[model samples]
Target: MIGGFGMWELLIVLLIVLVIFGANKLPEIGSGMGRAIRNFKKATGEPEEIDVTPENEKKKEEGEKKE
Candidate 1:
């Protein structure tokens, strides 16, 4: 009774998916789905924090001086 879907219902859905996609394509499909979910999370997630310590600033300044 997961999310209102019984075990049999879930098994039927999985069977249908397997039949449609074929066994050979299942791994590729799974990896593509994983990548899609990962990208979706990254797109909606917050911006990364910047580190602005004095050491980092000094390195930047040294690089600029070299240029």
Candidate 2:
């Protein structure tokens, strides 16, 4: 059971979603949901797990080290 709801209940909800949105829209929907969650976390002041520095910044740092 997931959060007290059984697997079948989850499946039913998924089916309803599929019927409402169709197959093609699912990926876009999922990505939008992910962005929403990420934004919400940021708004709540949660620290990100991974800090991504841009490639140009990394190259500059390496060049400075070499000089």
How many pairs in model 1 have backbone atoms within 3 A of each other, for residues 3 or more apart or on separate chains, i.e. clashes? 0
For each of the candidates, give the backbone clash count: 0, 0
Q: Cα lDDT of all candidates, in order?
A: 0.93, 0.92
Q: Please give the distance, in angstroms, between residue 58's alpha carbon in candidate 2 and its true position after superposition.
A: 32
Which one wins on TM-score?
A: 2
What are the C-alpha RMSDs, in order, of all predicted structures? Answer: 7.1, 8.2
TM-score of each: 0.61, 0.62
lDDT of 1 by residue, 1-67 (tens): 9999999999999899999999999999999999999999987795778566799888998899999
lDDT of 1: 0.93
